[model samples]
Target: MTEHPHVNIKRYRLIRTIVIVWMSVIVFAAFLLNIPRINILEHTARNLYFHVPMWFTMMGAVGVSAWHSVQVLRGGSIISDIRAAQAARVGAWFGVLGLATGIVWARFTWYVGSDIWWNFDPRQTMAALQLLIYGAYFVLRSALDDPEKRARLSAAYNLLAFSTVPFLLYVLPRQMASLHPGADGNPAFSEMTDPVMKLVFYPAVIGFIGLFWLLYTQRVRMSWLAYRIQGESKY
Candidate 1:
């Protein structure tokens, strides 16, 4: 029942306010900002503001999770263990959102003509598989009774799970024939995408990552508080 030193009321309020305003402005620009549209993409191109950021935020969250997992192994602190677990959990939630949004975007843009919501695109398939790997980490933690053992085991699983993210999301899918951008022979933003769009794109990525940190930190605080009160490790 040790207190985590990172939790603070004033700092939390400040970050919450900043994230709220950042997201508000991003939403406004996502709809209002004018950007070039291609033939198939058309208006749905605006989804770049929402869809792309989910994955980027997920990446940021996973990276944070892995860092904390390393701390768990090195520092051997229960709070570090809590942080590592919560971060991975929140990161996985973002991954789900990213996959869901990608499906919807593809449904409209890539599979617009037929009754095909999913055609087993390699990017989609790989991303889903990546999520399943993280899901198993949660299930594995639940099965273990010892707190220290669970922390060490879960941290190892998280490290292995994170290693697959880049290959699944970026490398393996691109090696095959896929409808997603960044694939071989497909149109990429480097040449086709407008510069003005990037003005919004990069900030959207940062804003969503910050939003993930806010949510992650809140959960860490809650899990810590619950652990303190319940005297159990399974928060």
Candidate 2:
């Protein structure tokens, strides 16, 4: 068995403190900072801070997961396997949040009168499909019995999953007619967006991605410990 890897507890704690403080400030600014409201978005505009950041965080997490998966394939270490699995798990949660928030924002802003919760908007549809791809990755991992076989197989599968992200989330959505900002040749969250919103929007993205890192690292540490103590990696 490989020697258990050491996680930098000091670094984790420091980043944990910073993420907490940073996100606290972001939450305050997201609600309190006033700006010229658009006709439809009005107060729901604030959802931009929360909703968009979730997707950003998810994408960041996916990238981290995929990077470690690459390391797993190259070296076949349980360390990279644990990191990849936890990062993808946490990342999927963020994707779910992003989808939920988008649905709520649409209910108020896009579908005000009708009782329509989901209209199958192109971006929304693609986003859901993207989550399912990652979902399969997890299920694929759980079905395998051997750690080395699971690690190698899942790492290859993970690379395939990550490859779908850009096209599903960005490219395909832009090609279809949809209620989302970037549809049919339009840029996502760019045109008609207020400059002041960008101030909070950018930081919110950073904070949430930082938050993903914190959660991902915590899971990595736990998984690493479990592997050390139990002699196998779970999940």
Candidate 3:
């Protein structure tokens, strides 16, 4: 029963406080900001604040998961294994949130004409497929009987499947026709845009990122503590 070094109770409290303040700011900004009337149709670009941040935060979580998976494979430490598994779980949760938010945004922005609930947009399809792949990663981890074998196989699969995330999130979306705009080429903030939108958008991104980190770190700490307790009980 080895003690995990990274689990700190005080750090968790600090993260919780930061996330609460960040989320409060995002909510306040969303409510107070004046959404501009872009065309004859009023465009509530405010939704971008929430919608875009979800995807970014999800990607960040998944990236952390992938890194931890690699660490488990290479380091072969139980703490690393626990952290990786917890990271994957958290990342999967955020992935679901991102997909739901993206769908809602799409419905509001582009579902004006067609009765089809989901158009075969490359970005949307790829994002959905990515989520499914990670979901399977969790199921695979659960189905295995041997602990060491489970850790090895799950870590391998996690690293392999992680390659798809960047491709789906960045590459394919840029190459093909996507209803969602490409993030890489264009400036997120432009001088031409309304000052109020910029004010809200930047803070929303920060807030959501803070929220994601807070959750991920908390999950990691809790998982580490559980592993330590289980080991102690076995002795």
Candidate 4:
């Protein structure tokens, strides 16, 4: 049997403390820093620090999930299976947050004065679909009777789901004219996107990704404990 990752209380506590403190600084800097003003983006530009990084965070989660799925398929590690499920669950949470934030940001900026919240933006539609795909992975896992079969099948499903994320979040959105950047010859970089924002923006991405890791590790521990107590998942 593949050895599961050993838990070190000291290490977990240290990492958790670092994540909390790092994100605290990021939140403070994201709001407090002054940035340049522009015609359409104006103050909403600050959202670049919060909204954009959420997708990045979700991407981080996707990477973790897919990595474990690959490991499970190759090594048949039950621990890898647990890790994949928890990562996907957390990743889906980030997708939900990213979608919700995008809607709010668009409502105030692009859809202001219009009675519309869901405008069927391609990225928006695809993101929701991606989350549903992950949701289906969990459902598929729960339905199977055998643990080994469930792990292998769900890992395969995760890989398939992971394949769609980049197309959904990046490639498809770039094909059409949209409110988001990187469309039409990669010219989204404009004067309004201040370089100063990167100070907070980059750190915010790192912080949120770190936060995802912290939560994921915690969930894995709990899931491992429950698995030890019961022969299978406890509902």
Instruction: Give per-residue CA lDDT, model 1, range 28-124, as digits (tens).
Output: 9988889887899998889988998998888888898999899887856888888888988999999999999999999988999887998998989
Q: How do the residues 1-235 of candidate 2 rate in per-residue lDDT, one tens digit apiece? A: 3433557777778999999999999999988999887888898888889998999999999999999999999986788899899999999999999999899899988898897899988989999999999999999999998989999999999999999999999899989998888899655677777899999999999999989988888888788778867887554
**C-alpha RMSD by candidate, in order:** 2.0, 2.5, 3.7, 2.9
Tell me the deviation in Å of residue 27 in model 2.
0.7
The TM-score-based order of candidates, best leading, equals: 1, 2, 4, 3
**Quick one: how many clashes does candidate 4 have?**
0
As for candidate 3, its clashing pairs are none
Better of 1 and 3 by lDDT: 1
Q: Model 4's lDDT to the true fold?
A: 0.84
- Predicted structure 1, TM vs. truth: 0.95
> In candidate 2, where is summed lDDT lowest over 10 consecutive residues?
1-10
Report the lDDT tens digits of candidate 4 across residue range 124-213.
Answer: 787788888888988898899788888898899999999998888888888976766666544564543678988998888898888888
Model 2 TM-score, 2 decimals = 0.95
Q: Which prediction has more favorable lDDT, 2 or 3?
A: 2
- Cα lDDT tens digits, model 3, 1-235, are 4444886667667878987987887888787777767652255566777777787777877788788788888856776777777767777787788788777667766675555568877778988999899989988888886777877898999998888888987887777766666634433336435777877788787887787777777777777667667762210
True lDDT of residue 139, candidate 4: 88
